[model samples]
Target: MVVTATRTALASADVLADVSVVDAETLARSGAVSLADVLVHLPGVEMTRNGGPLGTTNLYLRGGNTNHTVVMIDGIRIDTQSGSGGATCQAIPVGQIERIEILRGPAAAVYGSDAVAGVVQVFTKGGQDGFTPSVGVGVGSQGTRTLTAGVRGAEAGWRYALALGRETSEGYNIQPAAYPDRDGYERNTASLRLGKDLAPGHRLDATWVYSDADAGYDSTTSKSSANYAKDNRALQRLSALGLSWQAKWSDVWSTRVMVTRADDRYATLPAPGAVPSYNTQTQVDTVLLHNRWNWREAVWTAALESRQDRLSNAGTQPRDTSRTQDALALGYGAKSGAHSWQVNARLDDDSEFGQYTTGALAYGWAFAPSWRLTASVGTAFRAPTLYQRFSEYGFAGLEPEKARNREIGLKYSQQGHEFAVVAYQNRVSNLITFSGAGACASSFGCYANTARAKLQGVTLSGATHMAGVVWTASLDVQDPVDVATGKRLARRAQRLLKLGAETGWQTWGLKADLLLSGDRYDRVTDARPLLPGYGVLNLSATKALTPNWSLLLRMDNVGDKYYETARGYATAGRTAFVGLTWTGR
Candidate 1:
């Protein structure tokens, strides 16, 4: 079948998987300021946030732990060094993004470890047929201002692109009743891509990206005033470089290989006298190889992936750790009669966790001219992170978490409209319940293992196009239960809703979005009340003044919704920004 953005990839869907594609044009129109804001509209995806731009946040899929999710950029895996399994979306700004693909549901059979929750893959813009340059600036509510500029296209036998952008905002409060000011943040990002056609059958590409942020954090509780405590400043810096090569031997065979390295550092300070401080640095090296072959009756793909991670921390105490993992996999897919079938198997070896083998089977059948049905089942596992197994403050020896997932979905596509619905369930084993801060109080306290958990959910997502405009909607409902205690998993939202619409013309663009989530518990132990159901609106517009120049305006949280998130932590209030851009080709 011909694959398009509107057509869901069914092979991954059977085990209760769903995926959404957001192209460059849509990314620009969403006025998403950040990666978190951009992904909020995806079905079955939610965010956990704390107070401040640099605060910790995790992506929750079907009520899975944040560490369960895996993020990839241009085929390069990006994860924290501490093996905390948490990926900070704030590390990369939205303006540099070309497109984002969200693969929902369980992905362990394909990606190994962290794929237990889902996979988010991002592709950056590269050289085009010609050279182009653009720049823009904008200002808005909350003392917000933004500046961006970029150049893309090709030159000689080599294609190249570069972008530089900055965002700054005056502070806001974590809550209306609290005095501790929140919000003030400054971000600088730079990205580059270079590619060359080496020969008739070979190509080479290189990419580099760097981002830095200086932001304030609310150290006190919701009721604390800004005057009583100093504004806590936090910083996150990330730099990555990658190279890839691909070659085609013939019409039936092809090969691709890549190598990538990344370094990330995080730190937080309170005015200067704070006794407690947090700082960590991590580095990772990854290599991947993929080969594909085609036959009259079947097609096959095989891959080998490996990575090494090193982490170090310094403050009151010093720590060091390292980990390495390798995976080999093969897949076979064939078309017969009116149905397409796919089977895959993989084996993983980790220095820390022995080895694991996984497999999946899927089938897709056409029910009608414009309708299709798909079903799949897969198993995934996540090895324990260094922090989870050996931390200075609280040490725990935990086994890897395992999950089995199954899913079925339906899809319809015609003209410029598409619709899809998916239902999935994931059962987890060996859930780790660390000692809560207040549980038994202090250093002597120890944590208990929950043993097992289950999460089930259904997601309905669709998009329609009319008069050069696209409207998208998604709703997710998940019921997660603790199999051991028969209680609900804390912080797992029962309902997640996202809706958005956008229109783009040769010289004009406009968009709006809304996000809401049901109430969730804060701490797993006490189950404290965190955020309530809330909704927010965002809007943006762009107008091309000339072939190389454009004007832009953006407003975030336009409705000024006041709601807590991530354990009742204060969030950014409504804000706005304006910018201009110049492009050359």
Candidate 2:
């Protein structure tokens, strides 16, 4: 399989860094309801949520900040510039996703800012050679219902695909202690893709995706003693559009031009006599121009990118803001005898934060026929978000957060068995954090670059297939701490374990997964009690009824364990779902 870790495509076997891929078949077999479900099983990945299904979710990769990871959908950046500068992973529908590529470790040298930890790219379903149609319906716990339909085809020199889906659930209470009412959520999604071959080696493609949701949540700002029981609702909408043209100019040269636009809008309505309603909107526009050249033993790529970010808020305190960024990147990869190497460098000039330069170098040696060793060092940075710089309690003199990273990996594979181990360390400086001391010690504190941190971790993973069954397991041990006070970073588990087994016989298939997380602190200080560790089990089964039909059943949180990823939040208990799908070709 080809991977996009280096911007230019490379074979998975030739990559010198840690990477993971989740394809459509794997997603379908897992029967996951959200993207977070699939990512938590991967090595060096952790997720924390504030509530149940529709609550705010955050992902931490290799112990980095939630905003440190960059998210992309079909070459379009989908990271939001709202409250905390992260992707809205819960709002994305898994039914429309065809594949996901995860590149672990720092990738800022090739992807620019917001890549302090790694990168996640999602690819949606594409057109096929012939006319194909599919439909699915499912009903599950908590009065949940789902419906999805899609059609894809290609003929002559044109191809097209379209998908539509909807989901609704009368969810359980997310904040039982403070709010005694049940929360409910509803969502609708649509996606479209179109492409055409202009000439022999030239093609043009366009894609668009839309999602809208309404959900009820708890409010902590009410004045009345029973105000927490009142209703508080939020409406969210997202839209992404992209257009690109790719051409193979010669046997050794290729070029591409692409443009993308994304918009995110959210509105919150509080109970009467409580906090006033507010609306926030964020929009991003990006343009990319790239070229690649191939040689006997090496490949080289260069690209130019430009982006514009805009935000608008309407409430008692209204504001409007915008910024622009221009960047250039260069990358090279080569293989000689038993050695492979890669180098990347980038320079970004932001209209707000002057200029930043980052680079990375990696080397891989195949000492033995079935053994490989790799080492890499890189630098990364995260530019200050608009909210951090211009919000009501913002600070204008914040510097960009920066980090230096180093990693070493070893891999072994033989006879359908594979094992890998990787160790990494990252030291970050000028970390931006909220402070209620020094210059801004008022009621509304301001964000300041007043902290430093160090993160180090080791991950081990292995997989084996035998006797019609496959077994996979992974373990991660990490130490992430703040340098000044020697305190563990909040919401980051120090250890994690994941195990899975899958097997098939005749027309039936079964899969089971187990995840374990270690205790973690919920705040920067030790004054707050530590959140206890927890484990979850998930089971799924699929049976094929005919050539074009199938049935799926899934059970989540089988043990019905009560746990909290974040303090004062609630999690789902044991739940089950049954679904049926039909396809035509």
Model 2: CA > 4 A from native:
221-229, 315-318, 437-442
lDDT of each: 0.74, 0.86
TM-score of structure candidate 2: 0.97
Model 2: how large is the Cα RMSD against the reference?
1.8
Query: Which ten residues in a row are the worst by lDDT in model 2?
Result: 221-230
lDDT of 1 by residue, 77-143 (tens): 7777463556777787788889888877667667778788788877777878877787767777778
Number of the top lDDT candidate:
2
Candidate 2 lDDT over residue span 1-585, tens digit each:
645588778888899978999989889877666678789899999998876665778989999988899888888887676666877777777888999999888999888888988998888888989999999999999999999999999999889899999999898887777757778888999999999999989999998988898888877623245545357788878898999999999989999999999898888888775467778888989999999999777999999999998878642133778889899999999999889999999999989998999999999999999899999999999988777777665666878999999999999988879999999999999998887743432366777898999989999999999888999999999989899988889989889999999999777899999999999998897675478999999999999899899999999999999888887777888999999999995
- Model 1: weakest 10-residue lDDT segment is 1-10
In candidate 1, clashing pairs total 30
What overall lDDT, based on C-alpha atoms, would model 1 receive against the true structure?
A: 0.74
